[model samples]
Target: MSEASLLKTQVVTLRVPNELKSRLEQQAKSQGVSLNNLANYLLTTQLSQLETLSGIEQRLRGRNLNDLKQKIAFLLNKVPHNPDLPEWDRL
Candidate 1:
């Protein structure tokens, strides 16, 4: 990336709850990032998720069980499954 690309970044100001501020500060320090950079990255990622979910929820709010089941199946497929081990017979 060139210097112009880095210089094209926008400045944003946001107020976080006091507890979250301390946690973010610690995370930023440990990751060797400035607080602003950490906040910007997190906010950008979460905001994108929020926008997507908001659209989905708006469409599905009053839908029926079939829709709900399909959503559940989609999420379940994304998760790794672990099978239960057989129980040992006690003496």
Candidate 2:
């Protein structure tokens, strides 16, 4: 055994939907790895991606007004314009 493998690790108790657990088990079996290993790999990879995106977001914050407005406009254009609505739905 390697030194890294011998290092102490904390246990985390996670509650997942039965269907999701079954899918994860199937994936782990197909990859010839234990469920714990697969979950660790997925969590580590996703956290890295989120950290990268967060860095980009922080750097872009309060940097561009026109660009942000254009992006918002582009998104707003994708929504269908409808004035007809029930009184309860009107803001």
Candidate 3:
């Protein structure tokens, strides 16, 4: 199946205050586009930014897990209950 076909579309009903609605319509008209197209364009831009941020977060999370694993391994390999002799720090 095509990528577009795999994605489903849904309609959303939003209630905007009159002033904001008027501004959006005015902005759309000034840009020579339909109100729906303008809204969709704005949403697409914002969603793209969020998607990029999410990908970055996923990458960082993977690195954090690896770091935690390394720390755990280091701790596990330490000597068991070794005495902290005063001379060790007497330099």
Model 2: how large is the Cα RMSD against the reference? Answer: 10.4
Q: lDDT per residue, candidate 2, 1-91, as tens digits?
A: 8999878789999999999999999999999999999999999999999999999999988878899889989998888767897778754
Pick by lDDT: which candidate is best? 2
Better of 1 and 2 by TM-score: 2
- Compose the digit string of candidate 3's lDDT tens values, residues 1-91: 8999857678898899999989999999999999988999989999999999999888777477878789988987784654675766432
lDDT of each: 0.86, 0.93, 0.86
Best by TM-score: 2
Each prediction's TM-score against the native?
Answer: 0.52, 0.63, 0.55
TM-score for candidate 1, please give it: 0.52
The parts of candidate 3 lying over 4 Å away from their true place are: 1-9, 62-91
- Runs in model 2 deviating more than 4 A are 1-6, 65-91
